[model samples]
Structure formats: C-alpha cells, structure tokens
Target: MLDFFIQPFFEFAFMKRALVACFALALGSAPIGVILMLRRMSLFGEAMSHAILPGAATGFLIAGFSLPAISIGGVIAGLVVVLAAGAATRATDQREDASVAAFYLIALALGVALISMRGSSVDVMHILFGSVLAVDEAALLLLGVVSSVSLALLAALYRPLLLDGFDPDFLRSLRGTGGGTLYHLIFLGLVVVNLVAAFQALGTLMAVGLMMLPAVTARFWARSLPGMMAVAALIAAVSGYAGLLLSFHANLPSGPAIVLACGAFYILSLFFGRVQGILLRLLPTRHLEA
Candidate 1:
C-alpha cells in the first residue's frame, strides 16, 4: 500500500513535478472557483477555458509547443475575450453570459481551425487533453508564478469580491460608477491565469473541471465562503493525488483521470455532503417548539 502510493513520486521526477503542479493549481484555482460559483458565473470559467484555445494554437504555430509562448498566447487570448465580452454587454442588449458564450464558441472554432492548419489530430489531442508526464521545469515555474499571483490578487480584492458575490448592486453603489468593474476584470484575469496554469497539467477541457467541480462539491459541504474555499482546495489537491495514482496504475490519461476524480467527489458530495446533500435533506427532522 505504501509503495503503491509513495513509490511513484519517490522514484520518478515527472511524477513529483506533476504532483507539485496539481497542488499549486488547486491552491490558486479552487478559491477562484468558489467566487465564480457564488457569483453564478460558473459557466464563465468554462467559456474562458475554451477562449484560450485560439491563443494557444497561435502559440503552437509560432513556437511549436514552446510552453512560454503557448502560455503567453493563451493569456492574451483569454483576456481579450473577457474584455470584449464585457464591452459587448455594456454596448448591446445582450447580457454578459450571452456575449461570453458567443465569443467562446467563435474562439473555440477558430483555435481548432488554426491548429489544424499546421498540426495533425494527435497534436490537437495533446493540446486539448494534456499529458502530465510532459510537464517540464519551465511549465512548473509558470504554474508557481501563476498560482502565487492569483492568490495575491484574490487576497487584495477579497472585500470587493465578497460584495460582488453577495450583492453586485450594493458593491457597485459602494464603489460608485465603475467601482466594481475593476475587481470584476481582475477576477476574470485571475481565472485566465489559473486556467493557463492548469493547461500545463490538464488540457483545456479538463482544466475547468479542476476549477469548477471542487467548488460545486464544496457548496454541499461548507456553509461559509471561507469554508467552501478551503474544502474546495482540499478536494482539488486530493483529487489530483488520487487521479495521478490511478493514471499510473491503470494507464489512463492524466488529465481526464484527474477530472474524473473530481467528478467522483461531486457525486459523493451530492448524496452525502453535510450542508444539503440528498441524504441529509431526505432525513426526518425533529419537531421544535415555538
């Protein structure tokens, strides 16, 4: 049992690197996930993940799988979509969700077309579903930098974020005209950065899973915002470990395996979590005297 769990990381450099990458990703991305869930922008993270594809494909075209180039491209592309979506929402009758959905769909199709122009299906699979074993020192460094920056920004913007989550109108009123906008932009930027970081370990599609699933599960388990963030982070890190081990032993794809692990947690939380799980909700309640 010990060797099965410990030997992989103990003996293999790639495994060690992958584990560290997952932990770092969870630390930064999980809290952001909580905020997104609270703000009912859960799908926004998914849209942003797909939005990264065009930039990453552009990077692949320019540098042939160079990590930095891909990351930089992804960041630029994701941020552009975010800003564009916001601008469109403000300018048009369409809501923010509709604008974001439209942009991501276009971005996704464009990204695939660009990658197909230069590479084969195998390359596309590699980009869309990453191989954790391919993680290198540069990728590790990028993950660390992104995670650190995300945590710092989240801390600095906590008050505004809390307000945005609970009462957007109140937050806007408190900040006055255009007050909450900066924080919203910053929050989206953090989401983009973390998604890029996870892109190194998990592919574009699976990356959002790590960010959102744990948060969704945490909602069932934790009542407070801080508690939800903590539980989500913990679930993400644990899922990373379990998923890596499952991949090592069963020859599964690393990214999807990790995501599946998160999915499993979600299922369990839905049935058994303390806050409002199906089981708990179905149980009989004791009568109370008024």
Candidate 2:
C-alpha cells in the first residue's frame, strides 16, 4: 500500500507538476482566503473565480497561445468586472453583493457561450473542472510569479487590509489615505490572479472552494489570525498532494478530488475542532443529565 502511494512520486511528471502547483496555490490562496473570510467577502472570491472564464477564453483567442497569457488576460477581465461592479453599485440602492452576483452570473454565461461556440469536451472540462496533470512549464512559471507577487503585496498591505477587514468605519474616520484604497485594489487583483493561476488546475468553481474551504475549516482550530492562515495553508497543501495521489490511484478528476479532500477536512473539523470538538458535545450532554 505504501509503495503504491510512493510509486507515483518517482514515476510521473504530471504528478510532480500537480504537487508543485498545489503547494504554490495553497500558499498563494490560503492567507488571502483568511482575509476574505474575515471581511465576509468569500462571495466576492467566488464571483472573481467565475468572472475570469471569459477573460481566459478571450486571452486564448487573442494570443492563439499560452495558458499564462490567457490567465493574465483573465485576471485583468476579472478585475475590470469587479471595478465596474463596485462603481455601478456606488450610485444604486442595490447592495454590493447583489452587484457582485449579477456580474458573476453574466460573466459565467458569457464565458460558457464563448467556449461553447467551438470548444471541445477537453476544453470545456478544463474550464469547468481543471487538470492538474496537464499543467505545462509556462503555467508553472506563471504560478510561481503570481505567488511571489501576491506575497509581496500582502506583506506591504497587511496592516491596512487588517484594519479594513476589522473596522472599515474606523478606517473611514481616519479619512482616505489613498494608500488604503490602493492596497484594496491590489489585493483584489491578487485574488483575481490567484483564481486565474489555479483555474486551469482546479477549475473556476472548485478553485473558489480551494480558496475558502480550508480557511473556514482552519478557523475552528486556530485561535489567532496568523494561526488560521498557517493551518489553512497546511490544509491546502496536504489536500493538493493527497488529491493528486487519490486521482492517480482511483482514476478520478484531480480538482474534484482535491475539493473532496478539503470537504473531508471541513467535516472533520466540525466534529473534532480544538475549540468545539465532539468531546465537548459529549461532555455537555453528560453534564445536562447530572
């Protein structure tokens, strides 16, 4: 059994790519996810993930080429949509979430329509479900570049983002620093880029899951923000590797497999979290009888 698990580490190039991509993705998405969760903007992440598909297809159409170029184009598209949504909402009575959902649904529809014109099943699969095994060298390099840029941006903007997340009213009272808005835009861009980078390996739908689920699950066990981020990253990394192995051994789709692994952790965390475990429930029930 151990050899069956260990053999792919030595035998497959795709497996190697999958592992590396997942690790990079985990690091890139997890901390950002914690921020998103903190701000109650997990839906925004979902919107951004879905919003990139048309950009990706357009990039492919324009470049007649690489996934990285397509991904960059997708990220740009997503950011544009987000900016447009925010601007549109500023003048309307409609809430920000409503605007986000409308933009996401429209973008998703457009992307599907565009792809459906002449795309193959494989192309459709890649857009909807991702293929970690299909990651090329260029895509890998793009992932690394995206991850580095994201980390640098996070380091520079961490304090402001924290402030914005925890107390937007206080930030507003401090009056516009301009830097705060800039950091927010840059962070949004990072989210878009992360979605684009992971989309090919985890699909638009599941990529958002990867970004949010681990972070949410980590909250049950982590008492601090930094601890939550660390646990989220670890969960993402482990699930990525485990999903690849499961896919290889079970002939399953890698992205969904990874999501399933994340789901497993979420369920486990629900029942066995450090702060709210099954033991706590059992003990309380016994005390009720006493």
Candidate 3:
C-alpha cells in the first residue's frame, strides 16, 4: 500500500516534475489567492485569468507551444485588462466591477476567436486545459522564475498591500512615502505573473481554481491573515499531491483532477471545518448559537 502511494512518483520522472511545479504554484499563487479573497477580488482575479487566454492563444499561433512566449503574452494581456479596468473605473462614473466585467468579456471573446483560427477542438482543449503531466524542463524553469519573482515582490509589498486591500484610506494616507504606489504596481504585477505561471500547468479555468479554492477553504478555519495564507498554501500543496495521485491511479486529466480535489476540500471545509463550518453552526447543543 505504501508502495502504491510512493512508487508512482518515484518510478515516473513526469510525476516528479508535476509535484515540483504544483508545489511552486502553491507557494506562490496561493498567497496571492489569499489576499484576493481578503480583498473580495475573486471576480477580478477570474477575469484576469480569462484575459490570459487571448495572449496565450496568440502565443500558440506564433510559436507553437513555446512556454515563455505564451507566459509573456498571458502576462501582457492580463496586465492590459487590469490597467484598462483601473483607468476606466477612475475615469467614468461606472463601478469598477462593471468596467472589469466588460473588459474581461472582450478579452475572453478575443481569446476564443484567436484559438478558433489555428487549432482543432483537441488542440484548443489542450491550450485551455493544459497537460500537467507533460511538464518539461523549460516549463519548470518558467514556473520557478515566475514563482520566485512573485514571492519576492509579495514579500516586499506585504505591509502596504495588506493596508491597501483591507483599508485603502490608510494605505493612501501613507502614499507620501511611495509604498502605496509600489504596492499597487507590484500587487498587480504579481497577479499577472502568478496567473501566467498557474495557467501553464492548470489551464485557464483550472488555474483560477488553484488560486481561489484553497483561499476560500482556508477562510473556514483561519482567523488571522497570515494564518489564512499559510492554510491556503498548505491546502493547495496537498490538493496538488492528492490530485496527482488520483490521476495516476484513475487515469483522469491532471488539471481537472487537481481542481476537483480543491473543490472537495472546499466542500469538506464548508461542512466540517472547525472554525465556521456549517455542521458546527447547525449543532443546537453548542453554547455559541446566535
């Protein structure tokens, strides 16, 4: 039984690459996910993920599966949406949500159209879903570089970002010191880079799940921001491992398997987690009933 669990990863080099890539993603992307949840920016994050599709599709059209070009294109596309949305929010009387929604829809339509131009349904599916088990050295390097840069920037901007996200007035009050602008730029950059990295292994929809599900699940059990980020990262890493194992045993697609595993964690947390789980709330014998 132990061998069953251990042998697959040991016997297969691809499994090792997948594990490393997932762990790197968890370390980097999960923290960003935590902050997005705290800021209630999940919708924005999802929009940005969709925005990555057109850039990636264009890259595929140009380079035929070149990882770096696809990542750069995705980052560029996501950043453009972010900048445009931010500008429109400030320029117009419309709400930020509405502006972002419009931008993301446009981006998604462009992505689908670009994809439709070159690839068959199977090829398109590969771009949208990715092949996690087929991660090669170049992809690994790209993930590593993106993860490292993201973690560094997140660390540098942590305090200002927290203030900006949780209390923008306070963040703005400190704008004279320049940390506010730094936080805004770096935070946006981190989102773009993390999404690009995640999309490489998890694809567009599944990649967003990798960032979001763990954060939301961690919300059930964690009280402090730091604790929430830590739990989210752990959840992401564990989901990656379990998902890969399940895929190996059952012959499921890796991207969707990892995402589905994250969903399971979210469901379990919703019902049974110790903090604010539904099961706990429903227990009439508890002294904490509201």
Candidate 4:
C-alpha cells in the first residue's frame, strides 16, 4: 500500500515533476475557478483555453517548442480574444457569451490550421492533449510564477471581485474611481495567464478541466466564497494526485486521467456533499426555534 501510493513520486523524476505541476495548477486555477463559477462565466474559461491555442501554435511555428515563445504567444492571443469579446459586447447587441463563443470557434480553427501547416499530426496531438510526464524545468518555473501572481492578485482584488459578481450595478458605479474596469481587466488577465500555464501541463483541451471541475464540486459543499475556494483547491489537489497515480499504473494519458479524477469528485459531491448533495436534500430538515 505504501509503495502503491508513494513509490511513483520517489522512484521517478517525471512523476515528481508532474505532481508539482498539478499542485501548482490546483493552487492557482482552482480559486479562479470558484470566481468563474460565481460570475456564471464557467464556459468562458473553456473558450479562453481554445483562444490561446493559435498563439501557442504560432509560437511553435516560429520557434519550435520554446516555452517562452509559446507562453508569450499564448498570452497575447488569449488576451486579444478576451479584449475583442469585451469590445464586441460593448459595441454591439451581441452578448458577451455569444461574442466569446464566436471568437473561440474561429480561433480554434485557425490554431489547428496553423499547426497543420508546419507540424505533423503528432505535434498537433502533443499541443492539444499534452504530455504531463514530459514537463521540464522551464514549464515548472512558469507554473510557479503564474500561480504566485494569481494568488497575489486574487487577494488584492477579493472584495471588488465579489462585488462584481454579486452586485454589478454597484461595481459599475465605482468605474470612475478606478475600481470596476481595472479590476475587471486584471481578473480577465489572470484568467488568461492561468490558462496559459495550465496549457503547458494539461494541453489546450483539458486545461479548463483542472480549473472548473473542482470549483463545480466545491459548490455543492460550500456556501461561502472563501469556503468554496478552499474546498475547490483541496479537491483539485486530491484529483491531481490520484490522477497521476492512475496514469502511472494503468498506462493512461495524464491529462485525461487528472480530469477524470476531478469528474469523479464532482459526481461524489453531487450525491454526498454536506451543503447541497442529493442525499442531504433527500433527508428531512429539522426546524429550529427562534
């Protein structure tokens, strides 16, 4: 039992790196996931993940698989899509969700076309699906920086973000005070940065899974924002650990295995969570005297 759980990380350098990457992702992306869930922009994270692909592919086209080039390119592309979607929503009758959907669809197609133009199918698979066992030092460093930055920003803007999610009119009122727009932009930037970091470990397709599943599961267990974020991070950490182990023993893809572990947590939370699980709902509620 001890070897089954602990030997992989101790025996293999790749496993240790993969676990570190997953921990970085859990700490950074999971909290942001709670925020996204609060704002009801869950799908937006998924869209932004795809939005970064063209930039990554472009980086690959220009500089092979260099991390700096790919990360810079991806960050630029993701931010562009976010800014464009915001602009379109403000300028036209289309809603933000519609605008984001349109742009991500286009961006996804463009990214694939660009990758196919200069790279082989294997390269495409590697970019889209990722190889967590192959994570290098540069990628780990990037994840650490991204996670630290995201946590700092989230702490700085916690109140404003809560206001933005729950009371948009009030947050809008603070726009002239350098509150609304600034906070909004910072939040979106953080989203893109986290996604780009996640792309390095989980690939474009599975990146959002690490961000979202834990958050969604946390929702069933926690009612307060802080509690929810904490639960989400814990869930993400557990899923990452279990997923890596599953992948090692079963010869499975690391990214998908991690995501599946998150999904399993989601299912269990839905049925057994303390706050909102099906079992809880099915139980009789005791009335308290005032």
- Give Cα-based local distance difference scores for all models: 0.92, 0.84, 0.88, 0.94
Scored against the true structure, residue 89 in model 2 reaches a CA lDDT of 91
Model 2 residue 70 lDDT? 77
Worst 10 residues of 1 by lDDT: 281-290
RMSD of each: 1.4, 2.7, 1.8, 1.5
Give per-model TM-scores.
Answer: 0.97, 0.93, 0.95, 0.97
- Tens-place lDDT per residue, model 2, 1-290, is 78787789788888888889999999999889999998899889989998998888787666644676677778888987989898879889889899989988999998887777777767777788878888888888988888788878888877778888788667766757675677678788889989998887888888987889899999888988889988999999998888888899899998999989988999999888876666656664554452
Task: Evaluate residue 86 in candidate 2 and report its C-alpha lDDT on the 0 to 100 scale.
Answer: 86
Residue range 89-114, candidate 3, lDDT tens digits: 88999898899899989998999899
Off by over 4 Å in 1: 288-290
Show the colliding residue pairs in model 2. none
Task: Show where candidate 2 strays beyond 4 Å.
Answer: 173-177, 278-282, 285-290
The total of clashing pairs for model 1 equals 0
- Give candidate 1's TM-score: 0.97
Question: Considering summed lDDT, which 10 consecutive residues are worst modelled in model 4?
Answer: 281-290
Model 4 Cα lDDT, one tens digit per residue, 1-290: 99999999999999999999999999999999999988999999999999999999999999999899999999999999999999999899999999999999999999999999999999999999888889999999999999999999899889989998899778888766577778888999999999999999899999999999999999988899999999999999999999999999999999999999999999999999988799988888878711
Ranking by lDDT: 4, 1, 3, 2
